[model samples]
Target chain A: MSDSPSARASRTTGTVRIVGAGLLGASIGHALRRQDVDVVLADVSPSQLRLAIDYGAGRDARDDDRPGLVVVAVPPDVTADVVQAELEAHPEAVVTDVASVKLEPFTELRRRGVDLTRYIGSHPLAGRERGGAISARADLFIGRPWVVCRDEETRAADLAVVEALALDLGAMPLEMTPQEHDRSVALTSHVPQVVASLLAARLASAEPGSLSLAGQGVRDTTRIAASAPELWVQILSANAGPVVEVLDALASDLREVSDALREPDAPGARRTIADAIRQGNEGVSLLPGKHGQNRRFEQLIVMVDDTPGQLGRLFGELGELGVNVEDLRLEHSPGAQFGLADISVAPDALRGAVEGLEARGWRIAGNTND
Target chain B: MSDSPSARASRTTGTVRIVGAGLLGASIGHALRRQDVDVVLADVSPSQLRLAIDYGAGRDARDDDRPGLVVVAVPPDVTADVVQAELEAHPEAVVTDVASVKLEPFTELRRRGVDLTRYIGSHPLAGRERGGAISARADLFIGRPWVVCRDEETRAADLAVVEALALDLGAMPLEMTPQEHDRSVALTSHVPQVVASLLAARLASAEPGSLSLAGQGVRDTTRIAASAPELWVQILSANAGPVVEVLDALASDLREVSDALREPDAPGARRTIADAIRQGNEGVSLLPGKHGQNRRFEQLIVMVDDTPGQLGRLFGELGELGVNVEDLRLEHSPGAQFGLADISVAPDALRGAVEGLEARGWRIAGNTND
Candidate 1:
């Protein structure tokens, strides 16, 4: 439960007060309570405050001892306002935020001349389709990555405390600049949602019969389209520059492919198609590979049954054979005999996993190694 | 078990004899058997045949009357030879091949002057990650769609038989010209796969530590990357023209996006970014909407608890309110007070679902019809 690098080496009696009592704040409180850490949840919205308390986010806020830390969980637009308020109330407490974008808040904090030593910026890459305090869960951060953005001016003690917070919440702590974090998220999350939403909106106007022919492929591409426009509008506007930049790059690649298709008979079509595919391959590497770590990876294929027990049996076998199951994908092929299971593992495990499956009475065919 | 539109109309028992006891063939057998229709499963590989039989795909080849429908479900390259073999042995049978792509076989069958009245082209929109008879299930085709393609010269009875076959399997039957079917699929499924694969392949080579920050968005985009390249190569090569066209269009869009990003402050940058998102929306609409139907939707926010019976309670409220939920998204904000639930229902039912929740001691917020 403690992957965060900043967690204290020794146990102690101290409170980590989470200000805002929203999604991130409440979820952190929930996770902390599970760890037996003293926590207090504060929110200006009386309704929101009551919800947090009733939902067991934390006990009511108290003004006694200076807190070990104060985590500001709020929207990017109002984050600095809440953070400044928290600082005024608890100056000795270290602070951090779990906002989607960070650059603006950092600047706003600096302008206020608040001691910057005790605060860091954290964005845990764990969330669902919903938002707000009611959506908070103690286990939401488990086994997920948490990025900590630190500047040269960030105090080491505060940074360590923030890392400890992430660890206590059961998230892996990662270090990056605010810019890098924003750009990566734009490429991976924000942009995709925008794309999905736009697509979904279009379908709402499409002819019913035409869309009736839709299958799983379309479903996959549009899964995130159901996101809230209000939330996305805030997110996109906050990270507009980087997010727009990534989309521009993607658009250019799309244009080149379009041109290549226009001249199908030209000898260049193959190269263009090949290049497009290759480009996608390259871009995808920036994502966390199958290990849920952002490692660059080649794909490996394994066939698995669609039945409930089959997945369990397959996972159990891979474990027994010492074949690291880095990541697995199940294609939603409609009415075929068996579901094609593609597993992405280290290059080293490819051969063994394939051979192991074959020996275990599984039909292992095609190139098992990428 | 009683969905055959033509079963009572025609007393003929044997139809669609599937050759090759593999995944595709087994699924075909399963779908056909559900209609109380007998499908003979055959394979040159005796062991494979036994496996298919074990999975209840068919009876021993020694049994039954001459089949009216003959299907070749072997690997793509062998599809032609097997189709020709079945046609030769069962001259009275209407024949088809369930290959991923059909241009080659369609031409081959034409050259052979096989009974035009007894042959057509069909592809079912379904399959799993795994393969072979052991993984077969009777309900594989339920509610999925099957595409049956025909040309001007196609026999009337052949089209009817295949359409009936689809109905018998409880699948929606869609009619298309062979060329149209190929191009549509190229846009919807094949190209998407190549793109996903390309991206996933790229992720394979990314920096190890950075990949840890990869999240669900990347996973969703690259899910199809784990496909078997050999199988994919065959599919792409067969539909190169249409696939190249779509990929090129995508590439064109990508190019525009990249060019805009190069000059971030340019007016063109904003326009390009918006266009890319808009196009994505347009493309997404080409997909089926929620619940396998296209319906205009708005979301209703509900505060749901994380307790054991809480989800049930929320669902029960929705059910009691008589709201047919169109879609639902769940999120757990880390530090927030409560989990957020976004339920998509028809515009008319937004008030009802919300009212139902509120009446059950649940709190509702945000925009709802009520």
Candidate 2:
């Protein structure tokens, strides 16, 4: 959907072979085919390979086909074996594996005594809750980070080929070592998954009445807990070292807070609890906003009736006022006749947007700008 | 805006006095005043009281005024003292305090050996990130759970008055004991706040590059960590017993997962991690949906260009097709020029909505109905 002419022109040259026709593999094939590059699809599961091809991702591999580049997209558990097999089969081509954990596969390949010069480990930060070719989209990787784990021993030409693949798929290529890449994801992705799951697990024995009182807080914190356990088990095991580090730190912090709550009047108990939250405030502020900067957008909550076209009318009026909503969340409790459409706009645009909406008979429930 | 004649007729009769003209207090006053009930506002801060009155929340308290109900909405630390004072000052009035923690104030008043027949502890599960009379809204409690703690010694008439107050504000009144209410909120609210804050505090020392790779998971998990530490410390401490119970349980799960990750190849390690996530799945499923039922809605992610009117056009088309969106979330990456408006509708409406949008020249990126 985001294909650009400049991006299409710089697409990887020559025929490309993809092993493991899953979501990532098929998505790559689709994006590459849009650029008019030749693609060959292969997978251990004949049904999966056939489905990917039927979906127009690519064509089946032929005996005479000589690929210039091979991409491996498979689960982390079998990623190294697939990458090694592809490398041995295509000595003339650069090989890249898009496994979530870069270090494990790279280390496994090196331990197997495979030559690493032609291999580049990569991971694209894009996915859906569901998996397989059915969930594949040509623009899945667009504007997302595609980390390339490169070493000094790698040839520039080989590195360029993998980077070109990322670019052709509309992903921004970022260079990092295998260790750095694993550690980065450990903090940003893996640990959050574990924490969310652990928090949600506590609710298994909770009373339904307790859960009936659940608000946006617990909902936000546990939304990702609905992820498939089979997939996460592999991910957590593959990146165990880094994930363990972050989990241990979180456990220690949790212990201190729990102990303080157990004896709130004890010396420094309140300070300990307060400091944990204060540090949290500092940590969350470090995350980049929509424009990839440390800018804080002003927010307005406009009440909308829970009827068809009410949101359409509100947003339509917002458009007429020339206000661009940077972020939006629609919140409505059960049994309520109206919903609150919380929207964020640039700080400079907050006053005018609020004034225009109020003038247009919209009820401003709340605003951060006030 | 939802001031139905039926709701207005059932409003608490005579004058209603509100102590501590903060967010909750002023919001209660606004909603009650909308029902044509007289409200008198009082606060320690003269400016706050003046501002709340000027905002049409209520009028200045007079010596000649005799209130039939008094609502005490003060900070948790001073809630007990203020409630005791208000009860002593208004012997004939049925007094209710809208403090977050019910057990503390009720216990303190009982410790003072004061008559508890007129006092009913209540909490409306409504708040904004910002506070004060300036943030007050008449419909703040609409369709929200309003927990009222009543004992056997309470008279039916007094309880009826409190229930009427809840109904007049458009809240669903729920009856619970002081202990039960505290425990329920601890499981649903207090512990989640601490867990979120502790998880977010880990990001304070993370590399900026690592933060750049942040995605929807981490963003949702830590969103509530931005809450004010001063307020959270009081909440955590006031309900420390129940909060500690939950936190300890969470810590045990975290330790088990951490240890398993530390030795992923050990026997039963994978099963341990998988079990935690599976239990999370079961736990999150217990929460109700937007329809006040356990119904699962189908989701559709429609891509919208990041322009002023793109969202309006999309929703307008959806309205024309007669689709009622149950919930919506807008997602966009930093450098992406487009955003994805993920909307959930009734499962029965999914096919028609998707087909209608596709026919209208809209790009339907993904849908759960597939």
Scored against the true structure, residue B209 in model 1 reaches a CA lDDT of 53
lDDT of each: 0.64, 0.88
Error of 2 at A306 (Å): 1.2
**Best candidate (score: TM-score):** 2
What is the lDDT, from 0 to 100, of the residue A291 in candidate 1?
31
Q: lDDT per residue, candidate 1, B63-169, as tens digits?
A: 54588888777776677778777778888887877787767677767797765555677887766555667666554565567888787777787678777777666
**Cα lDDT of model 2 by residue, B54-112, tens digit:** 99999999988889999999999998888888888888999998889999989888999
* Residue-level lDDT tens digits of model 2 in A76-150: 999999989888888898999898998999989899999989999999999987789888878788778899989
User: What is the lDDT, from 0 to 100, of the residue B369 in candidate 1?
Assistant: 40
Give the distance in Å from residue A329's predicted Cα in candidate 2 to where it truly belongs.
0.5
For model 1 the TM-score comes to: 0.66
The candidate maximizing DockQ is: 2
lDDT of 2 at B51: 95
Stretches of candidate 2 off by over 4 Å are A1-7, B1-7
